[model samples]
Target: MITFCKYALCFAMSIKKNNIRLLQNQSYSWLFAISLLVFSSLSYGQDTSVSQENDANKPVIKDDFEWQIILDLSLIYGPTIIAGIEQEKLSEYLMPGLLVDISYKGFYLQSNQRRSHVLLGGTELGYQLFIEENWQLDLILKAYMQGYDSESLIEYGGGDAELLAGLKEREVTIGAAIRYSQYFEDALFRIDFAYGSSGEDENENHVGGLIIDSFYSYLLPYKNWDIYLGAGLSYFSQDIINYYIGVSPDEVLATRPEYDAEAGFRAQAEIYAQYPVSESWSFHTGITHSYFSNNVKESPLVDTNQTTQVTLGVMYVF
Candidate 1:
């Protein structure tokens, strides 16, 4: 009976050991499977995240086309002079104008007619190549026409009598331009550069140079309104300035022979508010300040000093 008892004890211990081994193997198998599943899921989630991030980085494309038309009128309210004659009081600076713009796929065609004492008109074809969501390069081809009165002519002495005799009151300009625009959530900023040629008479040769312009606009958060401020600067060579501001040598000799009229620099500033009635139309009002340099202002035939103007108009955006 004692021997039988001992054998029973040995068998029981053996069974317990086998059960332990089995449980250990089962636990290891479960752990391996769980680890593999977790790793696979983690890898999948990482891939999905990367894909979504790449898609989010892509730019939004606008495929629709739009058109806008604008009309403007303004008055010169302060002491102002057109060419050289000083008009002491508020006079009619009839600035009746139209602007048309058509845009498609980030490209635009623009045409404008503006009179501010001088009849000015221009046409431009431009393309916007976006660098990012809020930045773009604008390439443009522009042609402009500006007309001045006969009194605005700067007299030049005896160059070619025939050529001088045929000089007309109109000056026409054609130019090409490039501009950069940076857009913010509530504002936009831009800088532009241009080169152009102008001519009045058949004998007059066209000259071209740098034209710089810049503007900043801020949108008021409360209302359907925007405030815009801008300035422009232009530089032309002596040849170009002489073409426009030149006085006749004979006239110079008779008057102030020491005065040399030539193209220099011009600067102007404008501040405006636009209140939108709808998505397509708006009421616009602004103040403009124009200053001519000593070279331009000193011309006896031209009023080049500081001049201020108030303008009110309507604009449409498509």
Candidate 2:
């Protein structure tokens, strides 16, 4: 009985030891799994923080500005009168002008003025919708007024009894246009086209026709300056000129005029350089050459065709 009791104690001891080992192995396995889970979560959180920081440092792009303005002046020296039977010498005239461009987001207002045979003022209100980073489309309503002094009119009456008549004409033009601009490392290119009809009795009678204008410009590289070159062409029918000049085929025939203009065209070429000294100040110098068709140059009564002009001015941009 004693030997059997001793053997039973030994067996009991061995079973207890094996059971403890098994429990320890299971506890270690659970602890390892929990640790691995904690490490994975910590790694994910760190990556998220890094990503958010990068996003916070990203740059923002702004496509709107407060306002901009441009002023221009030109000295026009050319033939003020041309007639078939006679020709007039070239004369010089000072044409000072201002242009203001006010913008808020996509809306804009523009006003311009110049002096020539007539003092002219022009205004436009438009909405500029940006299609891309460099391209914009505009829908604008434009109006212009041309006022001339009585002395500016061609004298029809002879010497002491000469009659001087002054006239004021105005026109409203509404049009839509697309403008495309491409930016380079140091230069910019812009191209635009616009078409509109004039609305005024005088414009309809004398200046009536479709008006189209376009421009192309390339900026100089690496300077606060740019050089631009452009050309323009306009055609006017007999009806439009007759209304302003007071000479039509019927009227000319009735008066038996020795020479007269029937219809005409005007062409222009221009080159200018602009330098910006500050956000609100600039200097500009330019030259313009204009040519008028034979119909206008050969007319006996009027002679403002075929002229060349040069101008230098300082501008204030707002």
Candidate 3:
């Protein structure tokens, strides 16, 4: 535990300059998370047994939190999608994210296509609405897609500044979501229905959009490597489309004509590999590709029809 705290402080001191990140080929995030939970539980059980046996002999330290923290420092390479992002790009991949695995009851943020910040212990603020043997439902507060704006563009991909000069900044949001997860022997299927609100429209009206994501992931039980394959489709509503990538008449320029985005779909495919070097160290890498539909491609604010993310990194588990 002392060693773990040292690692935690080390991670914090270098959080911004750190280059490694977890390659969430959409599935490996949960895959590694689950593995950490299993190992943590086993460790805690052993500790508890020893404490019980020595109860009368000595004072045993009671550990309140039995959790695993992983530092995934990845060097990611990917294409730029949103305009005005080149100025914001610090490296090849804009930025890396840190993930925490705490043993708390809540709905995990399933698959949100939009790029958002990873909130520490963010998945803990959820209540289980229903639970069965392999299926469960939860109402959760999670980081939702902030629509397309400067921040997401900078981190995920970058582009020309002039092209997006006149665009409105979409605010980031954490909204409510209903998630359903199904577990199988070697796979997991999840669906999320979420809503995000950034701001009011030009008509002084508040508006929000609905997003539905369906994700399926399977794990290959390779003795030497942890391999995950994932595919998913995210459906965006018209309001969400326009809020993020669409154009309105008030904000249209001569070069960028007014265009309303039709509700459309974004498809993603991911493959990831993780190899454990020892009990606490491992090397991991993966690639994720998401293709935007014509509705999104047609947006003047966006310059690319697809985004590809690739990462090579090392993970330290304590």
Candidate 4:
């Protein structure tokens, strides 16, 4: 216990020394990055529908294409450390998104790939390389890093608003990915090897970058409800890290200095619960926590090493 206390003390001191946090806010300006993509569909809110391999009871599609549509409405409340936070303030966001999944033969396009794998998010445009009963492989273009505009900076918690002003807008990072997914009766696993490319954002990053992601989700089917537990780990090369959190030489200030981000890792875990009200409507809620390593935390542009959020929503399948 004494050793733990000492370690905790040292960690606090390190954060203070590194200038990692200006203030803790109830929300982040990058809310779209988390809310829009992460909880876009019924996969995170409502349960997914999948056909098992070797099961002859599945229905055959009579059309030239297969499609699924989901509409989601959610309220997200969270604690964030952004560039500005001064008062004791928290934020709540009402987020809405409509997702479509369409597949013709082995070619597919998805707005929320979360339905493909319980632990994955964002858009996926891909061609299936191989598909067997319980496993599948694909070549894909995957979008991950959520984009943010510079013009809409608000002080939700506490920090210097100027720190986020006058910066070029950041765009979503879409990269080429080789992905593998495995489905089980009550669980899902996925892994991806991605090579990032240049984004449309004004800021430019170096070339030759890699990102690795692995995730797992387990479902607990209670008599009256369904619960999903998930965890994920991602590793990014220096170039990829720099694009999201780095401070260019030209944008440096006395308070927000230039920061060159190094290769780092992010960890995420989530728990979601759903209660069905009818054949097409359900109540959903979830809590997610994401953490960054020192390579990201040390940057002056980053305020906290971690963020936690809770979501409440409803889902409708059409």
Find the candidate with the highest lDDT and give its number: 4
Off by over 4 Å in 2: 1-65, 69-96, 111-123, 129-135, 143-207, 221-224, 236-242, 245-264, 276-280
Q: How much does candidate 2 score in TM-score?
A: 0.52
Model 4, residue 135: C-alpha shift (Å): 1.8
lDDT of each: 0.45, 0.39, 0.53, 0.58
Q: What's model 2's lDDT at 205?
A: 50
| lDDT of model 4, residue 200 | 37
Question: RMSD to native for every prediction?
Answer: 35.1, 36.9, 11.2, 10.8
> Model 1 reaches what TM-score against the true structure?
0.59
Query: Where does candidate 4 stray beyond 4 Å?
Result: 1-64, 78-81, 85-92, 111-120, 154-159, 200-208
Residue pairs with backbone overlap in model 3: 20-72, 20-73, 20-74, 21-72, 21-73, 21-74, 84-160, 148-244
Candidate 1, position 290, lDDT = 59
Clashing residue pairs in all predictions, respectively, total: 11, 4, 8, 7
| Cand. 4 TM to true fold | 0.73
Clashing pairs in 2: 80-303, 81-303, 82-303, 206-240
Clashing pairs in 4: 84-158, 84-159, 85-157, 85-158, 85-159, 86-157, 86-158
| Poorest stretch of ten by lDDT in candidate 1 | 1-10
Task: Say which prediction, candidate 2 or candidate 4, comes out ahead on TM-score.
Answer: 4
The CA lDDT at 181 in model 1 is: 68
Candidate 1: segments with Cα more than 4 A from true spot? 1-63, 73-82, 85-91, 111-123, 129-131, 143-145, 151-167, 200-203, 220-224, 248-263, 277-281, 315-318
